[model samples]
Target: MSGIYIHIPFCKQACHYCDFHFSTSMGKKEAMVAALRKELLLRKDEFKGEVVETIYLGGGTPSVLELHEIRSIIDAVYADYKVAEAPEITLEANPDDLSTEKIKALSKSPVNRLSIGIQSFFEEDLKLMNRAHNASEAENCIREATAYFDNISIDLIYGVPDMTNERWKHNIDKALSFGVPHISSYALTVEPRTALANFIERGIVKNVDDEAAQAHFHLLVDTLQAAGFEHYELSNFGKPGYFSKNNTAYWQQKKYLGIGPSAHSFDGVRRAWNISNNPKYIKAIGSGELPMETETLSVTDRYNEYVMTGLRTIWGVSMERIASDFGERYRNYALRQAEKHVGENLLYFKGDVLLTTKKGKFLADGIAADLFMVNLS
Candidate 1:
């Protein structure tokens, strides 16, 4: 089964570290929503025989849209695509936008899951990140949302300058108190061209310490694992049966159609992404043109993608599948490249499947790079 991801590209404000495509202005929201519906209708034949098992609304903040507007998008999906009997529909929301009434309304809507962006439960961290929601709003929204949505996931950030390990622990403890089934946490990375990066460059903000981030990651893994949440992916921990179907499909390299500006899509062999400019995307869709670009994956591109995604999740890279899918030479090259990591205890073999050890989980990306089939066709 395939999935559908809708990107809502409007936010109340910008966070200091975010580089995702979005606009703070709501001037074109109505027009953009219409364009999104039109895009779905336009792309119906692309997935003619595929059943959509998951529908995800992600972006600047899907919560920014009105209830009817959100419903209209989903309605468009159902009207055109063949959806599963009970698909997992998720909406990525922010604490500031999730009022009590909004949560209640969403609970009754088609959205079955909520991914709340509560970067931190501390006022100082909230200010540092320039998050739209304050500490009180973060806690209160989760408290109210848990009552209505059982499949709720919350985001937390770590390694902020001046943030003590004790404070990080409290953040996790506070999240657990709300009984959230899933938590997605990431280290605060300063992306280039973002406010956070500029501040660091000007010495206004302290540079993010890699050592502190690693310590925080280990603490998170130990605490969450003790609490019975599986470290299903490198950065995602979920209780059994609560894993995100949409994200899982992504890591497994399943087919998905991404709608809206700056969104991306994959269909096993080809990958495509829409234009990042909202006005341009809307105008193109209105004119019956797809404002996107596509590229067919080479054998090496497919192999590298599999290695990158496979090593990050519980399911490691399968040597047999690699040999069959790519070629025997590619599989042999992977084993040769992985020999050093295997000896260092960073990676190990479970039969023919190469998996990362606990000590290696945090460095999965770098390790995957080492095993990448570079200079191969």
Candidate 2:
């Protein structure tokens, strides 16, 4: 099913490791809300009558917005699109913004799910990442939020420069204690130009250790799986009936309309992204102009995307789909490339659907790149 992703490009504070398109300033909040509503109306026909199954509020920090501002955006979506009877409306939030009063207000809204950004449960890790919330707030918010929402997912980061295994375990245990249905954990990658990157360059913060990250990944997989969380995607673990429908739809190549600055949209054949600058986006939408660029995917591009996403999620690439949709030539190319990895035990075929083995889960990205049809015409 198709979905909608709304990017809220404002955060209460800048996280040192974040490089996503967002502004720390809230001066343009009102103008932005109007612009977002206007942009939604502008692109109402893009989905081509497909019923929207999920509405994801991702962002600079959706939690930073007022409850009324969020409701206005949701109202705009309903006014413009054909949404499903019970769409999974999710709001990405930070612990610091999810106060008791705020959670109570959110429970009465259309947002059925809450994805909290709880990078770590230790104060030192929080300080290192410049997270907006302290360790106490992280724990307190989850405890309160769980009482109001059932479809909750929390994000945890592993492999911080000095994060020990014991501390990492504590984070996981703390999360499990909350009994949240889904957990999205990722490794700490120092993106260029981020404060974390600069710290490393200046020798102020130690570099992330690959070995330690790898170890942490295994720990995470084993711990979560044993606790009955399905390792559905490489970086996502969810119990039954709780896997992120929005993300799953995206991974399955379903079309979606992305709203707001730096947001992306795909209608199965063409992909587009809006201008990243908030001021430019607001001005353009106000002027009745869609500030975006589009690209139509070639057959090779589609095939590569399928391979990359397939390798990361539970739904592995189907050999039948490869031969039928991408042609025998592309199918043959995939088989030829997969042979080496299959022999290396990093990849295996389950009757024609190629899947990554547990040992190679952490290396899925690199292996998928190797299997890509780089120069195919």
Candidate 3:
């Protein structure tokens, strides 16, 4: 099934480690909303009449907007697309932005899922990341959100320099105690040009230790699995029937239309992304033009994408689908490459499905590339 992703590129404040497209200045919030509505109408047929099963409101922070602003965008989607009945509508929010009253109001809207950015529950961790919310807000917001919504996903970050093994366990325990159905936990990586990176260069903040990150990764798997959470993806865990449907659809290569600045859209063959600059996007859209660039995927590129995404999930890539889509040459090449990894206890074959073992999950990205078929015409 296809889905629609709406990007809200505005944030209340800049996180030191965030590299996502977002502006701390919200002067263009109103104008950007109007422009995005126009952009949605302009790209209405991108999905080619597929029934949309999901609509995700993601961004710098979608929860920062007023309830009415969110409603207006949903109203626009209804006006233009054939949305499925009881679609999984999700909005990404921060802990500080979600209050009891706000959650109560959001429950009244069409949003059925909440993805809260509760990165860490430790005050020091929050300070290091420069998250606007404190530890108390993170704890209370989840309690407040569960009161109104049953389908809730919270994000937690691990591997910070100050996050000891015991502290990491505490973070996982906090999420488990809250009875959160879904969680997306990530390791802290310092991207280039970010404030975190600069701090490291100046010796202000300690650099991230890869060994520490790897240790925490193992800890995450063991702890969550024991607590009855399935490791569906490398970075995601969920109880039965609580896995994220929208993200699953994406990993399976379903078509989705992404609206708003810096959003990416894919429809099997073509991929497009809107401009990252807010002012430029607004100006271009106001002039009745779509400010986006398109790329046509070659066969090799498509196969590589399939391998990259399919291998990351519990459901591995199918040998039959690979043979049909990319011919025997590419298929046999993949199988032969996987043989070495399989012998190393990193991957295993179940019938035709090629699944990675727990030992291989952390290195999935590197291995996906090793099997990639490059320069194929």
Residue range 161-225, candidate 3, lDDT tens digits:
86799999899899989898999998899999999999999999999988898889999999999
In candidate 1, position 310 carries an lDDT of: 98
Q: For model 2, where is the 10-residue window of minimal lDDT?
A: 41-50
C-alpha lDDT values of all predictions: 0.97, 0.94, 0.92
lDDT of 1 by residue, 110-163 (tens): 999999999899999999999988999999999999999999999999999988
The most accurate candidate by lDDT is: 1
Model 1 vs. true fold: TM: 0.99
- Arranged by lDDT with the best first, the candidates are 1, 2, 3
Q: Number of clashing residue pairs in every model?
A: 0, 0, 0
Q: lDDT of candidate 2 vs native?
A: 0.94
TM-score, cand. 2: 0.99
Off by over 4 Å in 2: none
Candidate 3: worst-modelled 10 consecutive residues by lDDT: 41-50
